[model samples]
Target: AEIGQVDGLLQDFPANNQAFRDANFDIEQLRKDIDQSE
Candidate 1:
């Protein structure tokens, strides 16, 4: 069903967003750590 597919996509959107945010945050933390070490 198209509606079911749409709902599934919507549900996945937040998870994807969170994953991206987490990755960005981790990268930022690593940058800070490296800067501190230098």
Candidate 2:
């Protein structure tokens, strides 16, 4: 998913936000990686 898309989802779902952080999902880094891949 796009960075903004996921970020919005997290904002709308607090529990998911916590789980995302707990899982070590680095959104910024993932965005950078995706950018470079493209």
Q: Compose the digit string of candidate 2's lDDT tens values, residues 1-38.
A: 99999888878898877878866767777888999999
Off by over 4 Å in 1: 1-3
Residue-level lDDT tens digits of model 1 in 1-38: 69999999999999999999999999999999999999
Query: CA lDDT of each candidate?
Result: 0.98, 0.83
Top-scoring candidate (lDDT): 1
Give model 2's clash tally: 0
- Estimate TM-scores for all models: 0.77, 0.35
